[model samples]
Target: TNASPSNTQTPEHSPTTIAVVKGLAWLFGSGSKTSTAIRETRTAYDLCAKRDNEESKFIHEVCRLSPTYQTWFQIANLHVWMVRTRYRALPAPYGKAFEQEFVNHFFLDIEDRMRAALNHKAPERIVKGYLTEMRDQWMGATFSFDLGLVGSDAELSGAIWRNLFASRGLDGKGELIGKPGKIGESRAVADGKAALAELPFHLYVFSAYIRRELKRLESISDEDVMAG
Candidate 1:
């Protein structure tokens, strides 16, 4: 006897995939407060972009080269720093755990959006690997900046320059490449101090934005658990 069509079942979506989809939907939804924060952040970036300084030129170049990835990296770096600083008052272990969870969720949502935008689907293993690498990048950035904080402003500027521009040698595409032109790098280094000067204020705004989003998510999760 032939098997019935009911015997053929489609695979269910993974919890991570479902959560990412839902999270992104909520994040960009029409009435989302989170969307407001995102818009404000973009507005800040836009204002920064309008300047004709060397720092602005560097920012524009990176955005021009790899808009999506560069933009995501900048936001993620700030968010991770905010998480680390915010949780510093907690015990060491708990602080580390909270940072990891926050970073994981942030990257997951980023990956989902990236896949959607590119019209690509990666295997679970591949997705996990990407997440692992991204987490490592976050930790590396934190450690690098921590050291920079103890050193001179020049050291901090070097760290920022490396993270923002020098770290990735790739062009707009994913291919390997050399450093940016000498003139650009020279101008960037000269402008770096001024740019770094503005970061503390921006960081404060970003931290508040991130904290509000996290509390909003926690409240939703609490409501779901209670309803369940």
Candidate 2:
């Protein structure tokens, strides 16, 4: 009898072939997905940036976080995290797109700010390095808050301390913890100790703000959020 078809299976796909497949898959059907993500970014940017009055009030008035690029990043990161968490309720794909746009907007805004203020006329490479460091903080906040949200009240408070307070725990007696003498760095980190004195009040208000936003977002229809 003729031997059965060769028992050997076809060779595995080559790396190049796999990459081409992925590219084609994304390209062929990604137009709407891309549009969807872009819309999310723009709408969120408008709501988050243009309507930043409340956030600014708390950060400056209640929290008293010193005005600087890092503080700005922290505030932005906090709000963005709140909104991003809400999007997790969306169907996975859509939610993923929304979350991605949320972060992309954060970085994009930072890039613009860096060019105008931080790196001011510096080479692109210098700015990129700063941005890279920021990316670590961004990712760290994402997880720290995630744990805090699910963990104990103390956990949430700890996350806020580490992030919103620049990891300055209570051990330092309201200083930079490691003897952060002076504060020429970042416009005026010297204000940090002063701000830390208000940390208790800041933590209370900020934690409340987070809880309230979570509740408000729950009531909002997915479509309404997308509309914004």
Candidate 3:
């Protein structure tokens, strides 16, 4: 008629088991935070990479850039760089990890584009060579822009001019190639001159956009950013 005494006792964990459980939690906790941060990086990248969106339209048509892969990269990379600055505002590990993961996605996307642009089955080294050059370009742009952020608006404008507006002259067929015809030579020269003349204005407008976006990002809820 009596109940067993062991049934009334609570199960207890040994010191070793408790320690192991704590250690495993730490491991997975760190990994999960990083994984969440990495997952959001794609959304951040898409902010610049989404096709024919307002950002792309402004870069291509209004800014007079040809719709080449290079132009797209410049646009994508510029926004990536901008958002990274704000990422620094996030708490320690998440901020650094997010910035790095965002960059990782950008380059991965670039490599895919390069493969398609060249032969789909292009040699790894060939695609890597282009990627190496791109890495250098990106490093230079970010360094210059970082200096610009701490300096003046003029400095930022100069950085944009050197990077984003560095798109090459395009031909009639929208290729960054071909020679001008007899009649076309005059038109090309005139167009080039006009573009040059408008360069200062566009640079100013782009600088404004950069400044505005950076400010706007600062205003967004941390929840939305962390959801990345």
Per-model root-mean-square deviation over C-alphas = 14.2, 15.1, 17.1
lDDT of 3 by residue, 1-228 (tens): 011112233223233334433443453244346677667877878766764345656766666765556666677788888888887788776776677666766665665565555435555555555666677788899899899888899999888877776632433222223224211111222366567667778889988888898999999877788885
**TM-score, prediction 1:** 0.43
How close to the true structure is residue 32 of candidate 3, measured as C-alpha lDDT?
40
Give the number of the best model, judged by lDDT. 3
lDDT of each: 0.42, 0.61, 0.63
lDDT of 3 at 91: 73
Q: Model 1 over residues 1-228: C-alpha lDDT tens digits?
A: 111112333334345555554654443332323333343334333322223232333344533223334344544465455434544434444434343344434554445443443334566765545445555665677786666555655555555545544433223232223334211122222334444454444344433444565455445442232222
By lDDT, is 1 or 2 better?
2
TM-score of each predicted structure versus truth: 0.43, 0.73, 0.73
In model 3, which range of ten residues has the least summed lDDT? 181-190
**Candidate 2 local lDDT, 1-228, one digit each (tens):** 111112323333333334433443453333345467777666776555532344666665555455555666676678888888887786656666666665555555655655555324565556656666666777799899999888876788788988877766455545333212111123233555676677777777677778888899989998776656
